[model samples]
Target: MAAVGGLADDRALLGRTSTAERVSDILRTRIAEGFFPPGTRLSEDSIGGALGVSRNTLREAFRLLTHERLLEHQLNRGVFVRVLTVEDVEDIYRARRLVECAVVRGLGAPPFALDGIAGAVADGLRAAAEKKWKGVSTANIHFHRELVALAGSARMDELMRTVFAELRLAFHVVDDPRGLHQPYLERNQRILDTLRKGDAAHAERLLADYLQDSLAGLLEVYRRRVGADG
Candidate 1:
C-alpha cells in the first residue's frame, strides 16, 4: 500500500482549495490508489495531524468520501474504507461493460492517439513479469482508465474514475491477487491489438466477454469469502 502521507505532495492543491476539499481530494486519491484497503480504520487525530488540518476538517473530508461511497462511517468505530459486496461487483462491471464497450464500439477508426492505453498495458506486462501482483492490479486500473479516455469526454472520465474507485473496494477483498489479475494482462494486449487493427466490433465483443468472465470470477471469490465468514 502507498503511504497515506503521499497525499500532501501536491503543493498546488494545498494552495488553492478549501482545507476540507483539499483533504478530501488527498484521501480520495489514496483510497483510489488502494493505500487504505477495505475495512482499515482511519483515525481522526492521525490523519488530521498528518495533513495539518483540524479534526472538523478531516471529518468533513470523510463525509465527502462517504458520499462518494469510498468510505463508510461506522458508529463508535470511526471511518473505514468501504467493503463491497458481490452485487456491488456485478453492478460495477455492468457499468464498465456499458461504458467501456460503447467507447470501443463507437470508435469509427484507428490511428488514434493510443499512447496512454498502450503504456498502461506495457506497465501491466512489466509488473507481471516482475511478479508484482499489486503493481499489476494498479496497472490494470490504469489500463481501463486509459481505455475510457479514448472517448475524449471529461465528464465521462470523471464518472469512470468514481466507478473505478468503487471497483477497487471489491478488488481489495480478493484473496488471490494473482488469480484475479494475471490472466487479464494478455487480454488487455489483445484488446489493444484488435483496436490497432481497426476492428472495433471485434474489440467490443472481446471487451464484453472479458468483463463477463471477470465479474463471474469476482462474484465467486466474494461469495466464498462471505461463506467462510459465516
Candidate 2:
C-alpha cells in the first residue's frame, strides 16, 4: 500500500510538471492576446484549479512571469496583470530609443547581424498580414532588440527585455495593433536599408523619429483607455 501511494505521488508530481508548463503557456498567450487585460485579478485557487495544478506549482509559474514583468503581485490582494501608464510608456520609449540609437551609432557598420534583424522584420510582416497582432508585436520588438544587440552590450540587451515586457503590457491596452504596427513595417524596412548601407548615423536619426511617433500614437490610445476605465 505504501509503495502504491508513493507511485501515486510520483504521478501527481509528473502531472504537476505538465500543468505548470501549460499554465505558463496559457498565461503568456492570454496576456499577449489581451484576454487577461491589465489590472485583471488573478486568483491562484481559481486559475490553478482551472489548469489542474496545485497552488504551489501555480505560485512558481506566477513568480516566473512576475520576474518577466508580465505580472505584478500585491500583498493580500494577490497577483494582477501589469498596467502601463502614460508615464510608463514615455519612460520605456525614452530608454529604448536612447540605448538602441546609441547602439546603432556605436556599431560603425562592420558587417553586423543584418540577417537576424531582417529575418525578424520579415516575420513581423508575415504576422501582421495574418492579423496575429501579438506575434507581430513580439517580432517587431525582436527586430529592434537585435539591433541593440549589435553593439555587443549585454547590459543593454537585459534592459531591453524589461522595457519590452512593459511595452507589451501597454500594448494590451490598445485595441488595433495592426493600426499601430502596420504603419511601422515600411519604417523598419527603411531603417534596415540605411543600416545595410553602413550609414549608422542616418539610421539613428530615422529610428529616433520613429520611436517618437510610435510613442505618441500609443500614448493617445492608452490615455483614452485610462479615462474610459476610470
Candidate 3:
C-alpha cells in the first residue's frame, strides 16, 4: 500500500484532455518512469483523489492500461503494475531485434540523419561520465527511441514508446543500475561508430547481437526476481 509520489505535479499538468485518457497517460508515464514500481498496489481512492478524477473516470483509465498489459486487476486485490516475466523479456527483445535492426539496416538507403542518434549517444556518454546511472538508463531509453525514429513513421514512434515503457518495467527489477547500464554505454557508442562508417550490414549485425546478449542477461535477472509469476 505504499503510494508513489509525483502524481500531484502530473495531475496539475493533466489539463484539457478527456479525463480518462489523461489519467491513463499520466499513470502510464509514471509506470514507464518507474514511479510506480512493479507489484505496487494502486488504490482507486488514493489515485482518484490525487488526480481529481471521479472513480468512474479512474476506473476507465485503469481498464485502458489493463488492456495495454501495463496493469492487471486481481479478483479482490485491486490493480497492480504488471511485473514482466522472463518470457516477456524474451518476447520484448525479439520485437526489438526485428524493429531496431531493421531501422538500422535501412540506414543510408534513404539516408536517415544521425543527428538524433548522435545526440542520444552523447547524452549517454555525458551521463556515464557524471556517474549518473539513472541518467545513463534514461539516455539508453532515449537512444533506442531515436533509433526507432529513423523510420519516420508516427505510428512506429508511438508503438516503440509503448514498447519501451513496458520494457522499463522489466528494467526496474535490476538492482544495480550502473552494472546494468555501464557496459551498454560503450556498446551504444560502438554501434553509433559502426553506423558512421556507413556499413549498415555490420551495424545491423552488431545491434542484433547486442540485443541477444541483453535479452539473456535480463532474463536471468527477471527469473531471480519475478520468476514465472508474471
Candidate 4:
C-alpha cells in the first residue's frame, strides 16, 4: 500500500469548508496529476491521519471517486487507484469524439471566446519548449477542457472532467510521454485556427480525425504495455 503523501498540505485547501466532496476533489486532482498512479493501494490510516479527517469522511471521499471510476475498493482488501483496460481506453476516446466534435460542430458564432483555449495551447507550447512532456500533456487536457467550457453548460463541464480523469489513468501506461502528446499540440492549434476563421465545419472535421488518430495510437501503446506487464 502507498501513502497518499502530502494530503496534510491539502488541509489548507479544505480551509473552512470540510466535506466529503471537497476531499474527493483534492484526491481527484492528485490522481489526475499522476501523484497517485494507477493501481496504487490507498492507505486509509495514512490518508485520514494526513488530512485530519474522520474515517467516515475519507471513506465517503473514496466512494465518490469509485463512482467516478478513478478508484476501486476490493472486498476485505483495500481501495486502489483504478487501472484502465484497453476497452476502457477505446470507450474513453469514443466519448471524447462524441462530446468534443459535437461541441465544435455546434458553434454559435464566429470570433468566439477562445482565450481559454488559446491560453491552454500557449501553455503546452511553453511546456514543450522546456522539455516538460508531462506539462505539455496537462496543457493538452486543459485545452480540450477549455474547449468544452465554451458551451456554458455545467453538466457538460462536469462530464468531461470525469472523462479526463479516467483518461489520465490510461496515460500512466504509456512510456513515451513526448511521442504521445507532442503531435497533438499542433492539431490543437489548427483546431483553434479553424475556429478563429469561423469555419466550424472544418474545425469539427479536424477534431473528429484527431480523436480517431489519438485513439488508434493510444490503443497500440495500451496493448503493448498491458502485454508486457502481464
Candidate that would win on TM-score = 4
TM-score of each: 0.87, 0.79, 0.88, 0.90
lDDT of 2 at 101: 82
Number of backbone collisions per candidate, in order? 0, 0, 0, 0
In model 2, the runs with Cα more than 4 Å from the true position are: 1-30, 50-53, 228-230
lDDT of 3 by residue, 146-197 (tens): 9889888899898888788888889888888887888898888988887777
Ranking by lDDT: 4, 1, 3, 2
Candidate 1: stretches off by over 4 Å: 1-17, 227-230
**Which candidate's lDDT is highest?**
4
Kindly list the per-residue Cα lDDT of model 2 for residues 1-230, writing each as its tens digit. 88888786587677667766678768977787677889999988888878777888898778878877788899989999988667778888988888888888788645667988999889988988798877888888888888888977898787787677678888877788888888888899999998888888899999999999999898788888875232
RMSD of 3: 8.5
**Candidate 4 TM-score, C-alpha based:** 0.90
Candidate 2, residue 209: lDDT: 95
In candidate 2 the C-alpha lDDT for residue 98 amounts to: 82
Off by over 4 Å in 4: 1-18, 227-230
Worst 10 residues of 1 by lDDT: 221-230
| Candidate 1 lDDT over residue span 79-131, tens digit each | 99988866677788989999999998888777666889899999999999999
Residue-level lDDT of model 4, residues 1-230, one tens digit each, is 13567687677646434588888999999998888998899999999899888888898899999999999998998999988888788889889998988888787778788999999999999999999999999999999999899888899999999999899998887899999999999999999998999998999999999999998888888888875232
Better of 3 and 4 by lDDT: 4
lDDT, model 2: 0.82
